[model samples]
Structures are given as structure tokens and as C-alpha cells.
Target chain A: MATVNWRTINIDALDPDSPANFDLSTLTATVAPVSTADVQSLAGQIRQLLRGGDNEGALQGALENPPYGADERGKDVHLATVIEILQSIRQSDMSPMLGRIYKSPGGTEALDVLMKYIYKGMSQTNAASTTRNITPQATGFSQIHSRGGGEGGGQAMSVLLSWHEKVVEIAGPGCIVRVMTDRRTV
Target chain B: MGPPEVHHLFHHPIADHSFSADRQTLAVARENNVDLYQRAGGKFQLKDELTGHDKTVTGVDIAPNTGKIVTCSQDRNAYVWEPSPQGWKPTLVLLRINRAATCVRWAPSETKFAVGSGARLIPVCYFEEEDNWWVSKHLKKPIRSTITTVAWHPNSVLLAAGSTDGHARVFSSFVKGVDSRPEPSAWGERLPFNTVCGEFLNNTAGWVHSVAFSPSGNALAFAAHDSSLTVVYPSAPEQPPRAVISISTQLLPFKSLVWSSESEIIAAGFDCEAYRLQGSEQSWQLAGSLESKGRPGVQDHREESALNMFKQMDLKGKVTDDTKLKTVHQNTISTIRVFEAGAGTVRKISTSGVDGRVVIWTL
Candidate 1:
């Protein structure tokens, strides 16, 4: 699986005052080894290097880099968890306020963010929370993680994930594990 | 107390037929003319003829909750209908899909829609958002070798797509257009485990002519070319397929199927036989068969003699290809649908085809 650089886009990039501007960012974890402390660290530093459109490195340093390792077959188990979380969230009726979602007038930014998360990797913990929430966003069973990217036309939209499912935990929002195939067959 | 048994509801057949959300109106497919019908006075009356399809019409659908009518065709286009004071009018011509479409279906909420085709060059399109308007996003590649059919979850953002290779795939009807800010109206299908909320279901005995999901979106029934009906549970991939029953009696195959709202009742059309699965008594005999309204049994002796007379024509040494396997019937079922009238119980179903005639039955 490809490792996602959690620090490529600054979490601070969003407006500090508006929760809408809050960035789901972390420290210079992209190039470091992950430990419980690395996972919990509040300060993040970005080591800038071109991987591909904000898609590179890991936020937390871990000997394992991407804790999920370089395995592809594990995607289905991860996907199954996604379904479970979605079902749980869908059954309930809670809608958490997402203070900050990339706002493209259309839906690409939100789309891209979701893709980036999928690409980055989904945290089993974060995923479980989203899945368990009974809010409209979690349970409606028909959500478009969309934004027009402020306007429309052509804008890049992607979802990355931090597979925090019991089976595997991925990283960031726009990062995808090269080996994992959640986009298909899952 | 059988005051009057409503035999069945008859639906008009053009090519593609879709039901409205509240199950009120139905739209029939026509190459250049799409017909909208009001269910009450008659099974299907010409409410209006929608134009814009430049070539043969391939598919038609009505939104589940709003009764918005959407149509797709060889013209490489799709149109969405909205309610107007005058009547249901074509409100949006949104965007044109590049591939010639074979089928179209709406998400349960009418918030999203899908279009599929046989052409591999073009991936299926599932449109959810347009900037200041609605725009379409697409699956990057063909889910199957040759896309043939697509159906959406009646109440959720899930999709069931069929391809010529006899495979059907279910996928997360992921909403499109995600920006940095959090979403307000997202209600997409959720996954239980690592598995996609959707899965690939049964392949048909032969090319599938049509597929229909129950009103509740609980079960899916598809009829194949061999006149066999395959009913499956789309959500439970863990369970084995429940049934793959054959609707014997037709040699050519079935063209369409429509399911009733309250029961497992399914009405299907074969060459000459219109078979339906009625009554949910929880028994195998729950299935009831309906013979063709006008099947010409074996031609009478005189007509047979006349046909034989024509067969008598011969160039003494003339070559002959395959002869008739069975006597050809004049009527072939081309389309089928089930809908509701104003009164909840007065449900209607109908069929039409080669005869170019329409028949309506009420339940």
C-alpha cells in the first residue's frame, strides 16, 4: 500500500476562526515513524517534496510507515467495515456538524477530500465514529460528499482514507494505498 | 366476498418503462416520443409525448420519491422531467452522456441517477451535483465487459449494474462533488465491514432482457432470455441466492418483468406467455401463471395447409436452411410494468409488445 503524506496540505490552511475553515491536519508525521505519541502529537511540520498533487509520505513516523503494511488483499475486510459503519450510521439519525469540508461550489472539493482520505487512508477510529454517528450525514444512506470546489467546471476531486478498521488502518483524506483496491471489487 | 377480483394492472409498453415514487404515474419509452400516463381513468393514457430523443429510445425511469421522469436513448442524451402546472414537463436536459445508453435508473431519493450501455468505450455515468447546477461524474472504467443494464436502490445510494458478460455488480452509489467544507445532505450507503455496501449478484441463464426491484428495495428480480426469473437479495451478500426459477412455456425468452408493491408478485413476459409470481402465502405454489392474452395455438388444419402450401414452393434442387423449430406466433411480449392508482389498493400492471397492443390488469 502507498503511504500518504499527512503533512502535504497544512491542516492550518483553513480559517482558524470558522470551524468551516478548520483543517484536519497534524504534524510532520508524513516522514516520521508512528508510535502512540506520534499518533497523538498536536504539532505537525511539513517536509515538502513533490510526490504527486499533495499525495505523498505519512504524517506519523512508524517503523511500519503505513501501519497497514504493503498488502492489497486486505482491502475487502476494510471495505466490509466501511459498510458496517455506514449501516450503523445510517440506521441512526444524528448529523454531526462538519465545521470544515473543502468547499468547491460543485462538490469536487468535498469529493476530493473524501477521495484524498480514501487515498491517504481512513483511520479505523475516525471511520468508526463517522459510522456510529446517528446523524443525517452518517445514516441517510445517500450522501454525496460533494462540493463544487467553490465554483465548477473542472477541478480535481478525490477521497483518501485512513483504514482504521480493526483489520487495517489507512492514513489522510486524499491519499490512496497503491496496493489497496477499495475503489473496486471491495 | 369476492366483489370483483382485480386480475392485474396493465402497463403500456414502448421499450423502457419506469414508475413514479408514490407509484402514481408511469412513463413509457418511445424512440422519438416518450409518453407520460395518469394511472386512474385507464391503465395508461397519453398524458403527453416527450420529444428530443433523436434516435431509438433505450431506457426510461421515474424518480422514486418525486416521480421525476428521466429518459435515455441512442441519441446519446438524457432528460429529466419535473412537475409543472400544465403537467409533467421536461424541466432539465442536464448533460449529454457520450455513450449510447441502454438503461437508466434513479437513486431512491432522486438525488442521483445512473446510465449504462453496451459500449465499453464509455464508462457509466452517475451524476449527483452540478456547480450552480447539477453535473455528472462517472465510473472511470467499465464495470463489466459489455454494460447492458443498471438499477439503483429504491431507498439508498446503491447501484446494481449488468453487463453483456452476464455479470451484475453492486457498488456504493457514492455521491459526487465533495469540497473542503462538510456536506449537509449526504446519505450514501454505509458499509458493515471492509466489503463495499454493494456486491456482484447472479449471472443470468442468458442475456438479461430486463430487471426490476421491489418497491421497498428489498428484493431484485431479473428475467433472462431463457424465460427464467432470478430473484436475489442485494444487501445480503453472505446468503446464497434464494431462487432461480424458470418461467417455462416460452422458447424465445422473456423481455421484461414488473413486481407488485405489497407482495413478491412479479409479472414477466415471454414470447407468448405472460407469467407472474403472485401471493406471498410462503409456499412454492405462490407462483401463478398467466397465459398469453392472444396466443395462436397450433394453427388450425386449414391455416396449416395454407402455410404448408407456401412451404410447398420449391426449386427442386434448392437448398434449405434451418426450418421452423415451432410454429411462429404473431404476438411477442415486448414490455411490462406495475403501478398504483389513486386509491392505494387499486394497483395496476400491464404489458405490450410485437402485437403493438396494450393490456391493463388491476390487482
Candidate 2:
């Protein structure tokens, strides 16, 4: 007699839970397409806010209206500004900033947008690190230099992870689910 | 005002269900068959079964005046069943699509019907007198994804469809020979086949699960996966809508909804209970749940004796029996249909769920 492993069975194939059954594209809003020029101007404004030592304003500006219709390049530019603002804020001020944002109107949606950016940044950092690991023929001196760069990337990742933990705590788990299912690009 | 009538038919999910005009016969899509139940002794008893498709039947609708039954299935086929002296006869419809049909609804006039499919198009099927068979004309353009549900206007010329693309669109299904010229309304004047009348998106871009036209067919309401119900009223052709009111709810997403009147909408889904929403075109809000708070059989306190606990753990390894829900329907309500109506107001409504229970609620 043969024993069956129910855990290993593909339940989605038997049920109607397959990804092919539901198209993710249908979950996106049909907003007017955003061009690269609009994103460039928004990025310049956020950079100015950061230069004036207004990190909270810069972060809120970056999150107020994500370019849902922008191309990859436009999204990357906006994401870089958001990362800069996140890095500038001290660890002690994280909870207070999040508390204020969560209590404000439309705060839940803004936090959801921030969650999307955090996940995107983490994935990109992981991809870059994996690509560097694929080429193992580096000399000892180059390896040392790469290790230093890897430590910087690791620090950035930890900061993002901490922010993720705080956002989930403030917004509840629904924010994460909303970010995953939301089709609006950030 | 009274306890709802519940009939637990079987332990299988009912994808859709419909009642005859006389309210004596009930048709439900169960698994791969359409089961017809006759009202006997104040209860529904299985009287006949219509089985043809090899896959699960997704939708079933019985014509009120014509006494014809139309069913669609996941096998990419549809059949029209007619009663004769010998038995019910089935006629195959030429849908001409390779994907599974999701839903089917007969027009108010009973002259035609619209079928939504996974192929991302709606096929409006009508009988061809010359060919002596049912044929379909596809509504193909501008639809980006699979259509989940479709509704027909009161005039039988306009059709509303909710699609996975997060859009609830109203289209002109005016077949030249089948439909007469409709009067100019807020939708448009020159209504032709495949004319796009209006398109509205959900607030959060969630998949539109259900779409319905009001009793007068003047307003459109849709429930999306974001747990929000949106109502759209068109002001005129090629202009902005008069009002687009959205009511967000804390309940789970609604799978089906029906208008009780011009001012009230009843919706239900995974929450396992029905809700009442009321408003005009200006604004809308969640009225409350339809389930009475003081219904019988709701055990507020359970005796927690040590012997009882030990016996329960000895029998099932669980402390409490939390299987039953407080609501009438134990699982997700899959479909809701108007059971009885008079003077443009729904007097009674019927709901069916995955728990295989069909419940009738008196409004």
C-alpha cells in the first residue's frame, strides 16, 4: 500500500484558487497615465524639501500622490527620494512620525503606499546582492571591497525592515494585504 | 419581520439560483446539474434534474413568462431547456467562445439573454427565426478582462456587466431585428449593437463582484472586492455623471446584491449575513445588517463544567463547537434573487450560499 502526502498535493489545481483564474491587471485603477516629466518635477520638489531639513514634509510629499501610471524609470526616481527621506529620520522619531501620519486623514492610504515602496526596495537590494554573489572569481582585495559595500546594503535593508514592522503595527495587517493586492504602482 | 425560511438542500455550493414567475418552482445550479424543486407542503422538494454539461454549472435563469430555462457552465457551453409533453427538451446555443461561461441572465422581455464568459466578452444570444436555432452576437470591443456578472435593463435593450477589470460598464445590446428603438435617455439616443453607454471603476480598483440595475433602471449599483458599493447615475450622454456615490463598509466583500426599491439595496457575501444600504443619488450609507439581533437559537452563555470540557476534549479534541454561525447562511452567500415583488418594490428576496441553504427573507 502507498501512503499519500496530502500536504504536497496541489490544492489550487483542484480548486478555483489558481492565479490564472484571476487576472491581476484587473485590480488596477484606470487613471490617466503619468509621464516621466511629471515624476522629475515631483522629485525635484522633494529634494528641495530634504535640503531645507524638512524630512517629514519630504516623506509626506513623496507618499501623498504616488505616480500610479508612471513608467519604471519614473517610479525609480520617486523611490530614490523616498529612500533618502527615510534614511534621514532618526530612529527615535520613527514612531512619533508614524503616529501622527496614522491619525491624520487619508493616513491609512499613505502608509499603504509607504509599505509598497519598502517591499520594492527590499526586493531590489536582494536582487543586487544575489547578482554580486553569482560572480565568485573576484580577487581577495576586491572581495574585501565588495564586503564593505554589502554591509552598507545590509544596513539599508535593516532600516527598511524596521520601518515595515512599525507600519504594520500602526496600520494593522490589512495595510500589508492592501499593498500586495493594490495595482497602483508606487 | 419574521424568521427567515431556510431550506438546507445539500452540502454542496450553489453557484446560482432562480425562482419561477408563479414562485412554485425553484432552479439551482448544483455541481454539474441544474436541480428543479417544486414547492410542496410549504417546502421545496427536488422534482427534476437537468444535466448536460460536463463541467460545473455556473449560472441558471428561468424566464418568467416564457417558462424557458437557460443555463451556462464552465465547459464553454450553454443550453436552453423547454418543457414539452414528454419531458423538458434542451437546445444548444452557439456561444462560439473557447472559455468557460461565468453567468447568464434572460432579458426582461424574455426574447434574448446575455452570457458573461472568461473569454473577456459578452455574447448576447437570441433565437433566429429563419435558422430555427439560438445564435449569439459577441460584445467584444473595449472589454479588457473576464466578465463576472451581467444585468439587463428594464427596457431589455441595455445591458450592464461587472468585469474582473474593476469596471462596471453599461452597453447597448440592441439587436436590430430583435429590439425596438429605445427612447433617448441619459445613456444615449442612438443605441446600436455594441455601443458603450457608460463605464465606471471601483474606488480601490478591486474586482467587481456584482452589478445590478435599480428597480426603475435609472441608476446602476455595483459591489467590488474592496468592500465598497458604488452607485452611478448618468446625467446625459457624453457628459459627466450626475452623481457617483460610494459607501464603504467594514464587512467582508459582497458577492451578490439586489435592489429592494429605488432607495434601498440589499447585499450579502462572505460575511454570512445580509446588509441594508439606503440613500438617494446624493449620498448612501450602510443602514445595518438584516439579521435580527435577538434571533432565537443564539446561545449567549455556555455551561463550562469540568466534566463537560473533559468529555468534549475526549470526543473531538476541541473545547467549544464553533462550527455554526449566528447568521442564517453558514458560508458565503453566492447569489441573491428577488423572490416576490409588487408595485416596483421587492416584497420578498431569496438568498443561496455555499452551505447549500436557500433562505427566503420577507422585507
Candidate 3:
């Protein structure tokens, strides 16, 4: 056994009941502005996206597997981005109905769940492609600027959602999100 | 630094060689591949090639007594291969780890060994039941940083890992029969490094390239990207790790540091030169710097030897307290060994470095 670097972190000394120790808090996330009800609503909308009758087949194909390290920074970035896109779509006047969808709390909840599945699908797709290669890939805006200082900040989720324009399409008065898939490319 | 007669030999073309645990077998993992060689008469000669890994095998470590060789690659896996009746063949492949594995080491008892990955620290265990190697243990949480070097304490229960992130991570070694295994806690610690990594993702010290423990396991020495060697009190759980002392200046990065078999003298190495540390205060005066034209790593070629640097020399440092360092050779030093292995002697110094050669020097 190697001499433990216990001096640096007496892991045993850390009380599970205590607040997060400042000693080991690296990259702690900041508080989010979304209300608890707003969060639940976004989760609900994403849940509807997974209903057995509504594009459940495509959703099934996408949710076939779970993602690893996808939760590394939590789902905040993903959800924020989803909200940003939904908001932008409503502002364009093409999806007045979509703007109404976000006016309530349930839509935000659905957005969170939708964002999770989308991120999960993204990770799975990337993993299958690089199983034999040497390094991990970056699939979103946050990751692109993950290196370097402060190039991306504030509503990171919003920034990433706006960045991937080709993957999404907003249509008509019925506020709807169209997630395009390219299974053939994989 | 005491006065000792040191000489440097010249080498040619490509240099830098590594030896097996028994000190008899030396393998050169060179520029595109690894070349296997054996000791014939007094020099090393081409033996056979051990090929299975895709990229150059940058690091190798042999388990004591077993003669088993483990090689790490840029291909994201550490392959445990052994030299058999036919030649080198694959035994087991430990996968899913840091893409770049810079170093590997085995415990003194040979039952366990460790590998250092680019962004994480992975310790693989040899399981006889499946006869395969698995990512048996590691830091509780993924370190998410690059690991550069690893070494085992002589007693064989403690293993230390150094990374480019500037902090050193240590793990406890487990024995086969021992009931009480000294496992590292769920989390690994982040010690300070000589320089600061300017990268935006993390805030730690500059890159720590190398680390070495004292003969008695009382102290640990480390080499960093900055031209310096840091000595620290390495074992504890209740206290914070603090640097006891550091040998640094603006000249060059000290690549390696080791203790004499007796635990009294310290040998330090810069990539091209080897020096010594003497006195109770551990004043790091220059000992021998390599002048060797021979393969540089030909210096420090013993298991029990705690000499640092490749086989080369310059001049000796004049200091008191039985801690003066004398010049050993003139070529670049790639490694250093205490000729007495663990005999606890302070007389013999062996080194190897850039020359890919090994040489023994006596004080």
C-alpha cells in the first residue's frame, strides 16, 4: 500500500452530516434562479415528451441507455439551454403557442426532463463512435469553452441551446420542438 | 557533498534504457517501440522485441522476484505482459482509463502494482481467479487530472502517484494474506506543487514530473516542472502535508530524487546532470553530473540504490556533515540507483538517464 496522503484529506475526518467541506470543494455550482415549481413544470413537459404515444418510438431509441459523466456538472447546463431555445422560439412570433407553454411552471419541468434525455442521447451517440479511440469528446457549447477562462458564462444552458441551431426546429403557433436525428451518420 | 571519483562515458545515436527488478534484464522502450535486451558479459545487447501495444511503451515496471513486466501506453490501457518461453506475450489488458499512462510500478512484494493515467490515477490488481487485471482500485472520485509518475515504498504496502496537475496522490498497498489492508480513504489529497498550472480548469501547482521516497520511508522527494525538488512529510491522516524543504533555482528542472540505501544521503538529478544532498539540513550541493557518452539511463542501475539521475557526471560539491555530493559522470542522467539496493549502505551509487546506459559508482 502506498503511504496515504491522509494529511491532505483525512477522509475519515469528514463528517457525512456536516456541510460540504471547503477543503475539497472544487468547482462548486452556483445557485440557480429557477423556482422550485418552475423546475417541476419543466420536468413535466419533458415527461410528456416521453409519453408512450408521443414520438415514444424515437424517444425510446434515444433513451435506450444511460449516460456516464453526463451528470458531472448536474443537469443545470442542459436545462438552461433548453429554456433559452424555447424562449427564443416564442420571441420569433412563429410559436406564440410555445411562448404560452413556458408561461406556466409545468413547461419548465418538462424542459428539464427533455434536456436530460437529449444530453443522455448526445453522450451515448458520442460514446458509440469513440469506443476505440483515446480521449473523451465535447458535444456541447459548455464543453467547447470548457477549457480557458470566462468565454462562456451566465445561462450557460441558454448559450448552448442557442448554439446548436441545426439540430432543432421550432414550428407554427403550436409551440413544439423538433429534435432531428442522424442515426445513419453514426 | 563528499568528494567521490566520478566519470562520465559518451554514448551515441539514441540513448535511455531501463532495467528489470533483478537488475540483470534491461529493456529500451525507445522512439517508436520497446526493444528487449539482456545483460551479456558486462553490457546490454539486443534480445527480442516485445510487441503487442500500439504506441510506444513510455514506461515499464517489473514486479520483484517475479520478473513480470507491465507496460503502459498512450492507447488508454496498461497491458500486463510477461516474458515467456517464446517471448513477450499478452497476459491481461486493463482498460477504460486515462488516455495517456506515463508510468507504472509494482509493490515490493510483487503481488500488486499501480499505473498512472493522464487524467486519472488507476491501480490495477492481478486476479488469479480470472487470471486477468482489472481496474481494481483508484481515488474514490475520478481525479480528472493527468498522472505522470508512480513509485512504491520499499516495504511494499504504500504506493505514490505524481501528476502534471502538481499534486501527489498516494495509495495504500494490499497484501494477499494480510487481513487488514491499508486502503486509502475515499478521497485523495491535493498537495502543493512548485509552480502553478495556468490552465483555467484547475488550480494546483505546476506539473510534478517525478517523486521518490527515502530508504527508510521517512521522507518523500519530488521533481516538478519548475527547476526544483521538494521534500515533504508524506504519511498522515490528521495533519496537512507540508513541504519540509525544496531544492530549486533557475537552472533546470530536477527530474528525479532518491535516498541512499542508508537513508543518510540524497541523490538528485536534473535531466542532463546528477547532484547530491548532504548534511542534517539536507543542503543540496552538486554531486556528480553525468558526462557520459554512454546511454544516459545507464546510471542508477540498482534496486536497493537510492541514487538519482542518468549515468553521467560533472563535479562534486564540498560540504560537511557526511552529506557532500561528488560529480559522478558527464552525460545526461536518466536514472539513479543505490548500488546496495536495500542493503542500507551509503557507499555505492548507480545511475542511468538519456544515454540508455547503466553504470555503477562507489563513494
Candidate 4:
């Protein structure tokens, strides 16, 4: 096989080991303050909404909390939690859900909206450096700024790209391209 | 002591490779054809191309003693090439399988060979004297899924197969007129065709990628998709194996592995590095990696000037040179073979990877 830029994992399509199995309660005690179970439950709700032909609702669900830029210095914790949750969802039974969504009415449009959010979120995270400009200077006292620096933003973008790759792998190249390039509708 | 011999052949993935007895000629299955490379003073040159197969050639084996080349492909066919006064003559073997042939191995005796196929059966083929053509008998029992790899025992009768069904099974391919029944080993006493001597599974039930037999033919080792290596030593047929020890690693799944020596094994795969695993029947553990950490004296140590940084930012997105991996192979190592071995141990090993490079490493 050729060397792919990203890692390829094969979760048995039939018996998928979903990311929902991740223990968020224990992880919250040590690292991020956010509840992982909440994100897992959110992904579950988004999956259900997408399956039920409510693609807009699913997109809204992903962007509502936004997972970052809300609390002070919460960007790293939020981004890491969101990335983990999306990665786990990628391991779920995605093909069937994607297929069912595409079969529903205005499904392509819904997929396009989701793709727009993913693409935009990834770009925003990559450009996180430009978003924050509090350079660390040599001083006993640290400068406090209203805007947080791009600490975990680039990693968040990378994780978003990883999820995008998995989604493309399941949805097929043509479908992904169609959704990605559907400009006027979005 | 020194760096391995590296040859960047082509852009396509090399499915399999075989070296001639004299070590002068190399045959590599690239795409639908096999390219033959001849060694000159220091480098190998493209000599010939075997272009009979219509589909992707999956496996290639060159019998050193007989100087014969056999290739199998995804087109559900196999061909045997014999060197003649004029050129290499191709004789098509009647491998009556509908699905693609996955792997092929020449037996020790050189009288027969085995072809693993997607049809869930292995075709143990031998040349029919009366017809002057190769004929095969299918080993159809107990195979649950597509056979990924086949390793022939030194005795030639016992064939070990690793399949997608997460099982490594040893079957007897003893043909009636091919040979005379001889000694009884730990595998079995009554040798018959398709007799499964021993069947082993990966601890995590992962797909078996590669299976190999020790030089002494006493131990069997297999690598699975779970990034674990299981070594099995059989005591007798229909009985629990003497020992089945599994060593799991944190590295990516290993696509290929070879027994460098009785106590050492070299496995390489998705990690882009070949690792040394050392031990015996009782227990086994990972030794260090076979690759050097970084490119010595080849670092881009030039001071990061503003102009260079701007140039780098304009050309590629990343400021650092993350394109090149530290290892010699930039991709997964697909096949690893004992390049040179003697006294029941391998002295040198060869690895071909998706990066279109073939490397020979001294152990």
C-alpha cells in the first residue's frame, strides 16, 4: 500500500468499536474540565439527527457550544475534547449513516452544510496564531490579555482534518467533492 | 556496520521480490508486470520485463537451485518461467480459481509450489509429466477466508497459511506421486493432502498478516493486524501446542516478518522501520530498531534566515522539514525475506516497501 499522509484505521463496519466507549468521567478528573460524556452524547444526538434527515440540526449541534474560545484558557481543553469525540465517532458505523442521510430528501444539501462547518472549523484552528497576538516576553509578571494565544488551535485543526479524511473515506471521493464544492447552496 | 544497499526502482508499489541464486538478478512484481534487474558493478540495472499477467502481479518467487521464476497475479492466474537458449519461456499453470491469487511460494524441493487465493483454498501445484504442464490439487477444507500469505516448511509437505479470518493453519500438501513418505515430526504422523496439522489464532483475533517458519522448521511465528507477534511450537497433532507465546507492540501493524535466526526475528511494516525481536520458545521480547535515528551529517543545519523562512512559508505551509521521515524507508515495508542465510540462520535480509525502494540489511 502507498504511504498515506494520515493514518488509516479499519473498524469492522459490522461490529464497530465506537468512541462512545471512552470513559470521560475519569479523564475529566485529571485533564480537561469539560465533560467528555457530554460531547459523546452530543455526537450521538448529531448522528441521530443526521439519520432522521435533520442535517441542519446536526450542523447546529456541532457549532452551538463550538467546543472552544468560550472560557478563559479553555481553548486547549475544549479543542482536545472535541477532537477526541470526533475521532471516536469516526470509528462508528458511519457508512450506513452516511448512506441513509444521502438517501433522505435534501440530503446532499445537509451534507454540504456539515462539510462547510468542518472545512471552516479546520481553517479557523489552523489560523489560530493570527487570531491571538499575546507574545510571551521576558518579564517577572505575565501580560494578561482578553484574547487567548493559539496554544492548541493547530492541533485542533489537525484533528478536524483527520475526521474529514475518515468521513471522505466512507462517503466516497465523488460525494465528498460534491459536498465540498457546493458553494451556491451553502 | 554500514548503511544498507538502497535501490529506488519505480514509483509503483512492489508487491513481491525474488533474487536469483547468483544474487546477480532480481525480479520485482511492479503493477501488472515483473521487472528483472541485473547487478552490474555496484548498482542493479533493468534487464528484462515479464509482461504476461493482465492484472496486478501479487507474488513472485525465483527458485535459486532451479533458476526458475514463478509469478501469480490478481487475474486468478499463475505462470512459470523457464530460462531457455533463446529467452525466458512462460508456461501457464492451471490454477483453477475464480478469485484473485494472493500469494505464492516455491517449495523446498522445487518440484511443487503453493498459491493462496481469495477463493478460500490453496492450490498446491506440481508439474504433470504426462501432460508436460503444471497441474494443481486444491486444499479446500477448513479455510474460512482469503489466504493472505503462505510459508512452506523445509520438508516441502507442510504449508503454513495466514488468513484474514485471523487464523494461521498448517496444512499437509502431500501429493501421492510427488514424494515418498518419510519421517514423522511434531506436526503429524499420517500425512495427507489438506490435513490441518495445527491451527493457531492471534490473541486479539486480528487478521494475520505474515507467517514464517524457523530455519530448523521446529517453530512457527506469525504477525497480526493487532500489532502482535505470536510464536507457536507444536508438540503433536490434535493436541495443545507446547507453547503459544504472543508479544504485542505499540508500533503499527507489521505487514511482513522473517526469521533472521532461530532466536531472532525481524519484522517491518506501517512504522517504516524494521524491528528486531529476540527470544526462543519460552518467551520473546523486542530488541532495538534496525534503523539509525536520523540522517547523519545530512541535516539542514543552515541558520533559519528571514529570507529562507519566508521562502519556506511561501512554498510549503510548514516551516520545518517534516516531509522526510527519519527512517530510510518513507513508507510501510511490504515484504521482508531472508536475503542470505546459512547454518539455519539468516545473515542478511531484504525488504521492499511501498516507497518504491528495496533495501538489503545485514543482520
lDDT of 1 by residue, A1-186 (tens): 889898795664564432235231220012223343332231121122112222112121111122232134343333333222222222112122011121223122222223323333334334443444435445455333322221221111111121222112121211222113121211
True-structure lDDT of candidate 3: 0.48
Better of 1 and 2 by DockQ: 2
Give the winner by DockQ.
2
Of candidates 4 and 3, the better by lDDT: 4
Best prediction by lDDT? 2
- Calculate each model's fnat, 2 decimals: 0.00, 0.20, 0.00, 0.00
TM-score, prediction 2: 0.79
lDDT, residue A138, model 2: 58
Error of 4 at A79 (Å): 24
Error of 4 at A82 (Å): 20
Candidate rank order under lDDT: 2, 4, 3, 1
- What are the per-residue Cα lDDT tens digits for candidate 1 across B209-280? 666666656666665543345565532444444443333221334567666653555444544445556533
Which of the CAPRI classes, incorrect, acceptable, medium or high, describes model 4? incorrect
Lowest lDDT sum, 10 consecutive residues, model 4 chain B, at B293-302
Worst 10 residues of 2 chain B by lDDT: B294-303
**Candidate 3 residue-wise lDDT, A16-128, digit = tens:** 52224434323322223434454445445555554433433222222222121234333443334343333333234423433343334444223223434444444543444
